[model samples]
Every structure is written in structure tokens, then in C-alpha cells.
Target: MTTSPLRRNTLKLSLLTLILMGFVLSGCSGEGESWNGKDISGLMPGLEFELTDGQGRPVTADQFDGKIKLLYFGFTSCPDVCPTTLQKLGQATESLPTEAQDDVLTLFISVDPERDSPERLAAYVDFFGNGIVGLTGKESQLRQLAKRYRTTFGYEEPDENGNYAVSHSSAVYVFDREGKARLLIRPDLGVEEIRQDLIALAKADT
Candidate 1:
């Protein structure tokens, strides 16, 4: 049977689409890479920051260049989300193989500097785990970092007790060893799923 011109054109287009899809699938399965969280590679810039650690020392992203870092922003006074997320992260990192445990670090940055002083921040992070580092800075510094990650925080009005709540992003931003953004872990992800993603990213070639 002879094919019409329109039929031939349609067949050619379909073949081209299949070829393109093959390339996409190949890319997805490359190096056996897989992530349970949102893959954000190249969607954001590499980690960069200048803040104070829990020990009252100045710190920058360069200090963590060779470690897989999880960046989270929330206040210490956060009634639920902050503590819950930190506990999950602590458990996840602790579950890693002893030799690989040190390869992961969690940066818990407090958005409420007014209430979370350096000393308080240090104690708060210590409650989570040793691998967790609590960092905070001036409001300006926190603002800039949040903007870099495309997240923000705001304060609610204080009650008669003069206590207020701060609202911020609950997702954890994961960065590879070289500090490039890689995955975004939602608050709803299980600890095991988070652990697997961290292991894969840590084992990936820098």
C-alpha cells in the first residue's frame, strides 16, 4: 500500500518523538540515580552563606564544601514543625552506616533571631543530634539566605503574653558534596525515604 504525503509526515513526527523520549528515559536512569524527593538540580544556585554557628563562631558555606548538607529554616520556638523535622533528620542521619554518618550535615537555620540567640540555638540543635548544626544571623542575613532558596518567613502578632510565632518553609533543601542544590525533601517524606536519597547523593561523584 502506498502512503499519502500527510501519512508520511505523521509517521516521521511520531518516530522523532519516540527518539526524543528514549533520550529522556536514558537520562533519568543514568548511573542508577533516583531520588524520592523533588529533584531540584540546577533549579537553584549552589549553597552560599555567612552566618554564626551555635558556638558563636562565624561560618560560611566553604566550611561544609565536602559534606552533603540539608538546609532547613524554622524557628526554635516553632511548636511542632521545627522539632519534628529536626528529629526525623537526626534519626535519618543516625541510621546511616557509621563510616558514612559523618558525610551528612543538617544546617538548622533559625528564622527568629530575636528569640533564638546563639547560646539557645546551640542547645536546641544539640538536642537533635551532633550532625545537626544550628546557625542563625541578623535578620538581614537570614532574609538574604531565604531569598536565595526562594523561601520566606513572617511573624505573627504577639498575644498578651508577648509570645509570637514565626511561619517559614518546612521543606528541607538538599545539596550535594560540592554544595550544589540537588533535592527538596518535603515535610511529609518518611525518614527512610529521606535517608535513601541522602545516601545516593552522598555516594554520587562530586
Candidate 2:
């Protein structure tokens, strides 16, 4: 009658996703100014993290100040969701006015550091677009960032072929230029909705 590590992690991740999804639903109920994405103005803290970039150099959230950020968590090995989400974000940023496009940035943080090396992350992100940056770090740093955003991730046991699956929140966290949390971009949102939300956030108080 003992729970395995995989089961424990999965349960914790599922619970965390439910809790954060509730916040997203409430934020999207139009409690304040309307936004295409869920308004998460005060649900989480401003962006802050100490991690390694795709180049294997250290980075902090403060280094990205003054640009609107779309922070997402996933792994490069992910067969579907990660690539799709990154592509959607890339498209959303590209749809912005040429001038406004540069104002938005997508930070793709990979939680599966065991397999996602800095070089692999760099190449993976490059396939997306210039507006996106790849990031990862030690498990401890990753956990801190995930915890800060009220999300969690877990890994499934590997099969005989040495392949595994990862469970992670598919939501993207949007922050304004000043690094204040602003919106939760749910996976169900389309490119246009995400684009519009990015435009508003990028142009805010500028």
C-alpha cells in the first residue's frame, strides 16, 4: 500500500493543474477590464527566475525587463503539445504590427533538464522564431519557477525503449513590460486571441 514516485508526482501535478485552471477560469470571467486571455493581474507574482539560457549562460527575469513576456513550460522532446504551443506563440507574435512584434518575447522553459540540453533547446527554439527564447536550469531552479507560477510538472516512467512522457501545464503565463503578471493564455485559445492579448499587453502604458 505504498505510492510510487511516478504516481505521487502525477497526483501532485494533476492537483496543481486543477487549482491553477480554476484561477484561469475565474480570471476570464471579466472581473475587471476584459482581455482575450484570462486576466491574472494579481493571482501570481511578477516574473523572477535564475536560470540558464539556451546558450548555457546564466539569466534572470530582470534581464528581460521592458518587454512583454509569454512564459511557457515544456520539454523539447515533447512530441506534440510543446511544439504546437511554441508555434502558436510564434505565430501570435509574428501577427503583431512590425513595430510591436519586437516588444513581445516568448520564454520557453524546459522542465525536463535530464534530456533537454542547452544546445538542443537552442536549436529547438530556433525552429520556432526569433521572438522565442529557450531556457532551462537545474531541477531546483525549475521547481522554484514552476512553484512561483502555481504550476507543476512530472515525468512518467520510461518504457523498455527508454522513452518517457512528461506531464506539464499547457497554459502560458503572460507578463507586461514591467514584469507584472497579466494573463493566463489557455491552450484552448486560438492564435488570433493570443495575438490580440499580446498586442494589448505589449502596448500597455508604453
Candidate 3:
């Protein structure tokens, strides 16, 4: 069979289009699988702040640079999630290898700064672990930090008895040594799972 010059050109163009489409589709597939059985990445993690730690000294996110940082956002008064999550984190941190543990930093950032004063946050975190750092600041500062991290938090009105609650994201963010968000662990994650992931992250090169 004889093929015309126009038919040959048309075939070449069609093959080129198919090849380009395959490349695009393959890239998308790989991105989709990057988070498979792992935490989501892409969100940036650190924000500049002059928050006060449990010791009443100034602290900034920069202090955690060049280490694996685990940041948890919650209030001291949280009836359930905050305490439980911190405890889990304590357990996880305890399980890390010495090298990994030395390279990890844990932070508790309170969304309810109105009531979660530095003293309150410090005591709360200390109950879970000695090395866990608690961060609290002016409401505006806390809100700005949360916004930078795309974390959501709000206060629920108190009932007739004047008791209130806070609704906040329960995901613990994992930041790589370079301060880039690398993964998220849900509140319900087991201590062992969190420990394993943190170890893997600490060992991962930037």
C-alpha cells in the first residue's frame, strides 16, 4: 500500500500528541501517589513569630529550623483531643532512636490563646513530656501563624454555665529539616505509627 505525504505527516502529528498526553497523565499519576499511605506535602510550614515559651522567653519558628519539627495546634482546655494527642506524641517521641530523637523538635501551639497563656500551655505540655515546647502568644499572632499554616480554629460559645470549647484542626504537621511541610498525622494515629513516620522523616535528606 502506498501512503501519501499528507497521510505520513498526519500520522506523525497524532503520535506526537499521544506521547505528550501520556507524559502529562503519568506526571499526574505520580503526584497522586506521592501521598499514598503517607502525609500530604506542598504546604509550607514555618512562620516568623515572637511567641513566648513555657519559660516566658521569646521563641520563633526559626529556632526549629534544620530539624524535624512536629507541630500540634490545640488549647490547654481541650477536653479530649489536645491532651490525648500530646500524650501520643510523647509516646512516639520516646520511641524514636537516639539519633532521630536528637534531631526532632516538638511544639504545641495553642489556638485558644485567650485562655491558653504561656503558663497554661507550658504546664500542659510538661505533663506530657519534659522536652515538648509549648508556644502561645497574642491572639493576633497566633491567628496569623495559623493562617500561614492553613490551620483552622474557632471558639465555641459557652453554655449557661460559662464553659466553652475550642474547635481546631487535629492534624499534627510534620516539617522537614528545611522547615517545609512534609506530612500530616491524624489525631487517631497510633503512637507506633507516628514514631515510625517521624523516624523516617528525620532520616530523610532535604
Candidate 4:
């Protein structure tokens, strides 16, 4: 028996999601990976980009190079996953001691520039709280940035009612103070585990 192309793609996506989800679940158990995250250091450290932030200011690597950055790609219209992930991140950092939480930054970059304006991004991200920056840019700029991380995202074809989902990565990419890519935080990671990881990074020597 052979699988149709569409079916094969769907199956592959399902498997990938399950595998990533398992990693998140195991990692959140406190019995799993260390608070430092599953070190991916020195690998794919090419996390650099300049985009317009929600406030209409240029956001560049230099501006954030000395702090730990948690980067996520998603859009505002996502029904569940996007908001949940952002909320989890916010909750994870909210109760940390001021110093620890202050040293870390979360960046939510929209993949749906076609409909996600800076104002829209601001509203979505602000709901989470401070220390989180909402960013969006020209579609070309976004693609280049995503390419650097080997992450893929794009708008799906609209149905008759013009509804569509923007296919995007949900994993959180963590970078150390030195700006080296350190960990890829999965969605299934609990708020506690995520908080500890950020605190660990925040408290480290600058």
C-alpha cells in the first residue's frame, strides 16, 4: 500500500508533533532534562535579525545581544496554540525574582505579516505582559530570519470563506547571554520548567 502525498504530509506532521510533544512532557517532569535546557549550544547560532517591533522601532541583534532571548514564531489569529504558548511563557517568568526575570527577554515574531500589523502584534503581546517584545516585518525579511534558524512558516491557502492557518513553528529558541543558540524549548514544557530555565540563564554571569 502507498500513501497519497497529502496523506503522507499529514502523517509526517502528526508524528513530528507527537515526538516534540513527548519531549516537552518529559522535559517538564523535573525528572527530565536539566533546567539549563537540552543544550544545543554552538549549533545553529545564526540567530540574528532586524525587524520592526510593535512600537515601530527597529529591533536588531545588537540591541539584545547581551541578554538571554526566547524567540517564538506565530500569528495573532491562531485559535489556541499561539496564545497558550505565550501565556505559558509569561506565567513562567512572572513570578521570578525581579532580577532574574529582568535579565531575560521574550520575542514573539509574527509569521502572518499580511494580517498582523505592529498594532495588532502589540495588542496580542501586551496581554502577556512586559519583557516580551512583539515583532513583525516585511514578508521577505521574515523569511530570511526564519531561514537562518531553519524554521518554516507560511500562510495556507484560504478556504471558500477566506479562512486559513499560517503554518509555523511553535518551539521556543533560547539563546544565551553571548547570543549562542542554546535550547529549543517545546510547547509541552510546563511553566515551572520554563521559568527555571529562564532564571538559570538570567542569573548566569553576563
- Top candidate when judged by lDDT against the true structure: 2
What lDDT does model 2 reach? 0.88
lDDT of 1 by residue, 1-206 (tens): 98754455445545543553343344453344677876767667899999999888999998998899999998889899899999999999999888779999999999889999999999999998789999999999998998887666767667799998676777798998899988878777999999999878877743
- Global fold similarity of model 2 (TM-score): 0.91
Q: How accurate is candidate 3 locally (lDDT)?
A: 0.71
- Report every candidate's CA lDDT: 0.83, 0.88, 0.71, 0.78
Question: How well does each candidate superpose onto the true structure, as a TM-score?
Answer: 0.84, 0.91, 0.77, 0.82
Q: Native-vs-model 1 lDDT? A: 0.83
lDDT (10s digit) by residue, model 2, range 108-180: 9999999999999999999998989999999998988898888788888898998888878888998888899
Cα shift from native, residue 174, model 1 (Å)? 0.5
Q: Model 3 clash tally?
A: 0
Models sorted by lDDT, best on top: 2, 1, 4, 3
Estimate, for each residue in 1-206, the C-alpha lDDT of model 4 and write its tens digit.
97654455445555655665555556453543366455555456556888999988888876887778889988999999899999988888787887677778889999888888889999889998988999999999998987777665756567798877776777889988777877788767898888887876666644
Judging by TM-score against the true structure, name the best candidate.
2
Evaluation by lDDT, superior candidate among 2 and 3:
2
TM-score, prediction 3:
0.77
